[model samples]
Target: MSSTCVSPALPDSKTATTDPLPDIAASAPTHASTLDWVGMEDISLPLYLAGQPVLARASAGVSLDAAGARGIHMSRLYGALRELESRELDAARLSGVLEAFLASHEGLSSVAEVRLAGALPLERPALVSEAAGWKRYPFRIAARSEAGAVALELEIEVGYSSTCPCSAALARQAIQEQFDRDFSQSAVDAATVREWLGRAEGIVATPHSQRSEATVTVGLDPLVPTLPLPTLIDRVERALGTALQTAVKRVDEKAFALANGRNLMFCEDAVRRLDDALNADYAPQGYRVHVRHRESLHAHDAVARVERRAPDNR
Candidate 1:
């Protein structure tokens, strides 16, 4: 009688199975809490910026204002980013994306932000040679929107050469000593001096030069029509003319050396020049410039920073 009590055969673990998927995100959270930002980062998306294709590391996020809501529709953000995959990111387009981010979760979020960062490849000509090459400049763009208000930020890193002022002065004094010692008792002739100057011993000592970086951040006023990324980069490079070079021939190297000598700058000089450049532009509401000279002589880098106070500020 006990053996006859077997029930109908049940499904085995080995059997193929498919069932309705769980929807946990829609379920109420165990502890309801508001989050400042909830979304994605380091998302890879292709972008065409300034007519060039860029593989951008894009991030999108939103504030969870509604504490009662279980969670935001994070997948919606991923889908919205697809709309920008093939587009050139501009201030207007970024604002639109932020708008969509908030609109996707009207009750759960009141603010949205998106950031896209990538290196932009630019064709560069040699200092004195006809050959040209490509160089990459890192660029970052961020836009935030809340309750129909929008703020945008643009950042780029510009590299240049900085020569030590004290080192240059010392180098000049050493050269004078070499000149006095070489011809102090001997007679001086134009050809003889030219031959000596062409020698490394004639130069005596060379000033220490370092590769320097300027991290420039600009806050755009709402009235600004375009992103003006190129313009910003141009300003920095123009202000600091001893920019990094790509192609290198003897002529190009000599030209670069000439440029570094002509634009002789310390870390403070570099920062002051960048500050002047930013002030000369009216499109930005505020700006922050950080110049760091990777000291060739010192283990630590020399740094200087400058910022402009925004009228509406932050």
Candidate 2:
């Protein structure tokens, strides 16, 4: 006993300090009131969608429904988000993330939601030529869970060409007048007229065509096997008939022009077309269609919105 002296800071065998790390989040709130949702945003993550890898901006949130809990576990929401990186970004897979978020905050949360936003480069071919190129479409997927029910939403941006129907008809009227004026003085032979039709002056006017956009958002039906993202894109492009071309040669440009000439639509027409197509498709439980036609003749864009509701299979 005379050889050793212990520091006062050292604990005796009977008394000892346990864990010292403080968990402020687990403490009770000073003022008691529940919050709707709280978590993180603009998180970076990778997604494998439709067999393609894409970088996405991710966000996750969970409701603070428990009035007694000070705060929900934010770290748990971030941890659950990691699951998206390992699986194909789809309805079934993303639903797991939503479930995990609520499960991790079991006592504090009853609702959870996550959003993944990114640009998907979709390869499309020229309308009339063999050339092809890539177009980046802004895409988003949202998953939400309340109580025990889960819902998934898929959103995509599609660019295409829209020519005015009235403009085309007016241009045709002017051409007919031009034909009458030109042939009034000259002999009307089939060869001469055909040769004139091939010339620049023969086709004096062309209806204006401008780039248009369709923002299609659909709620997926649980019965669908996989995410039909590719098919959704294909359906929109096919419905519009004048999808924005990637590569453009002289031949391709001509083909695109032909396509626009064939598929003339106003903003009203676009929403109706997309509305019908989505309603007819079996993969979606419901859908919302929004289209904007950047008018060539006017400075403002013409817009339309349509919603179609289907049976809630969920």
lDDT of each prediction vs. the true structure?
0.87, 0.85
Cα lDDT of candidate 1 equals: 0.87
Tens digit of per-residue lDDT, candidate 2, span 1-314: 36887766767757876777788888888878999889899999988887788999998999897777788778888888888885676677778788888779888888999988998877888766788898888888888889687777889999999999999999988888889899887678789989988988988888888899999999876435787788899999999988888788998888877888889999899888888787766434788899999988999999999877656543
Candidate 2: which pairs clash? none
Single out the weakest 10-residue window by summed lDDT for candidate 1: 276-285
Model 1 stretches with alpha carbons more than 4 Å out: 1-22, 282-284
User: Which residues of candidate 2, in runs, are more than 4 Å off?
Assistant: 1-19, 282-284, 311-314
Give per-model TM-scores. 0.90, 0.89
Per-residue lDDT for 1-314 in model 1, tens only? Answer: 35556688878868759696887766788888988998999999998877789999999999988877778898999888888878676777777778789889888899898989999888888877797998888999888888789988889998899999899999999999999998999898899999999999899799999999999999887546677877788889999989998878999998888898899898889999988878866434788899999999999999999888676664
Model 1 earns a TM-score of 0.90
Which whole-number lDDT from 0 to 100 does residue 267 have in model 1?
89
RMSD of each: 4.8, 4.8
